[model samples]
Target: MRTIHAPRLLLLLGTSLLVRGGQTLRSGDHERGDVPGWVMITLMSATLVAVILFMAEEALTTMFKAAMDKVNNP
Candidate 1:
């Protein structure tokens, strides 16, 4: 003859019941909210472009000045 602990048995039963209830209430229906993913993507792209241009500004200006000096002295 085997005996089960009352508290443990009750806890297991309660957990199983909760899990089953949750599964029954679950649904696949979802709403497409007003949040625009494209806007975030566009903003991120613009930020990257601005950072690249800012980082290269000095080098670009130096090259432009060199080109102008060569043109003027030639």
Candidate 2:
């Protein structure tokens, strides 16, 4: 739904843009290697947060399913 994937998609797009921009900047500058400083940090931070959120969402779904099973069985 809009309330769920919209925010996540926007966040992902923003992070992707930053990552791409950083790569371009670093590549343009021969002194730097791979991604730039700020881009590397930003990508890592976003990736970490996204992974945590994904895990939490999975946990929440599992918990909800368990609760439903208990209720249905009882």
Candidate 3:
């Protein structure tokens, strides 16, 4: 059985919220020109990075553990 990691889940949820918030900001009244395009782009880039890091966490952890074990046992 696969276990769900809470921190990873929170990261995903936060990324989703960031994306949704960015969309809402983009869809707001344009006449006021309150939302800048760069802001949305930055939010989306951050979300992407968060997701990538979340996905890579397990692999990175495994690699680190293996390296540590090699050093300790050698």
Candidate 4:
């Protein structure tokens, strides 16, 4: 029969307790932790899109006009 020494048994129990405590602390919900970072990223992406649209407005308009003309003429 394998017998656990008192010190070994105490160490095993403590390790198991720590593992269980860690698991309990981590609630398994999908954690969205960095709200501000995501918000900043989203804002930056939107700003880039706005700037690109502003800069390319004339070109985009011309392209659309050409595409429509081709479609209508076809």
* Per-model TM against the reference: 0.41, 0.40, 0.42, 0.57
Model 1 regions lying over 4 Å from their true place: 1-35
Best by TM-score: 4
Q: Which candidate is the best by lDDT?
A: 2
Q: In model 2, how many backbone clashes occur?
A: 0
Residue 37 in model 4: lDDT? 60
| C-alpha RMSD for every candidate | 24.2, 7.5, 6.6, 24.0
Ranked by lDDT, the better of candidates 1 and 2 is: 2
Candidate 2 lDDT at 66 equals 99
* TM-score, predicted candidate 4 vs. hidden true structure: 0.57
| lDDT at residue 23 of model 1 (Cα atoms) | 52
Model 3, C-alpha of 58: deviation from truth (Å): 1.2
lDDT of 2 by residue, 7-65 (tens): 57657777787777767786666655545566667666777777777779878899999
Q: Which residue pairs collide in model 1, if any?
A: none
lDDT of 4 by residue, 1-74 (tens): 99765446555655665565456557654464554465456556655666777689899999999999999999
Clashes of each: 0, 0, 0, 0
Colliding pairs, model 2: none
Question: Roughly what TM-score does model 1 have, to 2 decimal places?
Answer: 0.41
Give the better candidate number (1 or 3) by lDDT.
3
